[model samples]
Target: MIENIHFIAVALLIALGIYTLIFKRNLIKIAMGISILASGINLFLISLGYRAQGIAPIFTNAAIAASEVQAKMVLPAPQALTLTSIVISLAVTALMLSFAIIIYQKTGSLDATKSRRLKG
Candidate 1:
C-alpha cells in the first residue's frame, strides 16, 4: 500500500474536488473545485509514469553505468502531458473566475444558486 500512495492521494483529491463542486453554492468555490479536480488528474497522470528505480530518459549522460541501463526508464510523455494539463487548467480556472467576477459585478451575488439567469 505504501508503494501506491500516489494513487490513494489522487483518489482523495478527486473526491474532495467533487464534493466541493456538489455541496458548495458559490461560483468561486466551484472554480476552485474544478482546479482541484484538474490537479488530481495531473497527479494521476504523473503517477502513471513512475518507475521503480527508474532513471530519467537522458541517454547522453555517460556518468550512468551500463548496469543502470537495465533499470526502467521513466517516459517523458506523462510529464509533458501533466504540464499541458496544468497550463490548460490554469487558463480554464482564470476564465471561470473572470466570469464569476463579472457575474458578481452585474448581479451583485456570488452564490451559484442566486446567479442563475434562467428559470424553468
Candidate 2:
C-alpha cells in the first residue's frame, strides 16, 4: 500500500475537488475546487516521472558511463510538462478568482445560483 501512496493521494484530491465543485454553492469554493483539481493533476504528473534512486536528467559528470547515466537519470519530459501545467493553472486560478470577485462586486453575492447567468 505504501508503494502507491502518491496514487492514493491523487485519488483523494480529485474526489474532494469534484465533491466541492458539485456540492458547493459559493464561487470561491468552486475556485478552490478547481485549484485542488489542478494540484492533484500536477502531483500525478510528477509521480509518473519518479524513479527509484533517480538522478536529474542533467549530466555534468564526464567520467560516468553513458549507459549508467541513462539508467539512473529520470525522464525530464514529465517535469517540464508539470511546470507548464503549474503556470497555466496559476493563470486559470487567477482568472477564476478575479471573475468571482467581479461577480461578487456586481451581485453582492458569491453563490452560484444567485449569479446573473443562472437565473432564468
Candidate 3:
C-alpha cells in the first residue's frame, strides 16, 4: 500500500506538467512544465529500481562479503542515471529560460500568440 504512493506522485507530476504545457500560453509556464515532466520521468526510473528494505551494494565493513551483497543489495544503475538526468535537466531548463527571456525582450510579452505574430 505504501509503495504505491511514489508511483501515484509520479503520475500526478507528469499529468500536471502536461496540463500546464497544453493549457498555458506563457513561455515561462511552458518551461516549468517541461522541467516538471523531466522530474516525473526521473522519479519513474527510480521507482523501477526500488526494493523493499534493500541496502547499498557497497561493502563498508571487513566482515561483509561480496556474495551477501549480491543477494541483498539494490541495483545502483538507476541512481546513477537519475543523477545524470538531473544535470541534463538543469542545463536544459537554463537554456529554455534564457530563450524565454530573449523572446520576452523582443515581443514584450510572454504569450505564445504574440510571439507567433511577431515571427511572421
Candidate 4:
C-alpha cells in the first residue's frame, strides 16, 4: 500500500520535472527541473529497499541479542547509492546554475533561444 503511494509520488515528480525541462525556456528553470527529476529518481530507488517494520542497520549487542530485528531488513546498498546520487546531482546542478548565470550575464537574457553564439 505504502509502496504504491511512494511510486506514484515519484512518478508525478519525474513527470513534472520532465514537463518543466522540456517546456520551459529559461535555462535556470531547466536546470531546476533536471534537479527535481534526479531527486525523484533518488526517492524512488531509496523506497525500493524499505522494510515496513524494520529497524536501523546499526548492530548493537542488545539489539542483536533481543532478536527483535525483522528478517526482512532494508538493504543498505540502495540508501548509499541514493546518497551518492544526490551528492552528484547537487554538484551537477551547481555547475549548471553557474554556467547559466554566466550565459545570462553575457547574453543579457535567461531565454535559451536568445543565446546563439554558435549560429552561422
The models' CA-based lDDT, in order, is 0.92, 0.92, 0.90, 0.86
- For model 4 the local lDDT of residue 48 reads 88
Model 1: residues with Cα > 4 Å off, grouped in runs: 65-70
Error of 1 at 64 (Å): 3.7
**Tens-digit lDDT string for candidate 1 (6-101):** 999999999999999999999999999999999999999999998887888888864578777656667889999999999999999999999999
Tell me the tens digit of each residue's lDDT in model 3 across 62-117: 24567777667889999999999999999999999999999888879999866786
Q: Scored by Cα lDDT, where does model 3 land? A: 0.90
Model 4, residue 53: displacement in angstroms? 0.7
Q: What is the lDDT of residue 46 in candidate 3?
A: 94
Q: What are the runs in model 4 whose C-alpha is more than 4 Å off?
A: 1-3, 62-72
Residue 73 in candidate 1, Cα distance off native in Å: 1.9
Clash count list over all predictions: 0, 0, 0, 0
* Candidate 4 weakest ten by summed lDDT: 60-69
Among all windows of 10 consecutive residues in model 2, the one with the lowest summed lDDT is 56-65
In candidate 4 the C-alpha lDDT for residue 12 amounts to 95
Candidate 2, residues 24-105: lDDT per residue as tens digits?
9999999999999999999999999999988877777645679888788889999999999999999999999999999989
TM-score of candidate 1 versus the correct structure, residues matched by position? 0.91
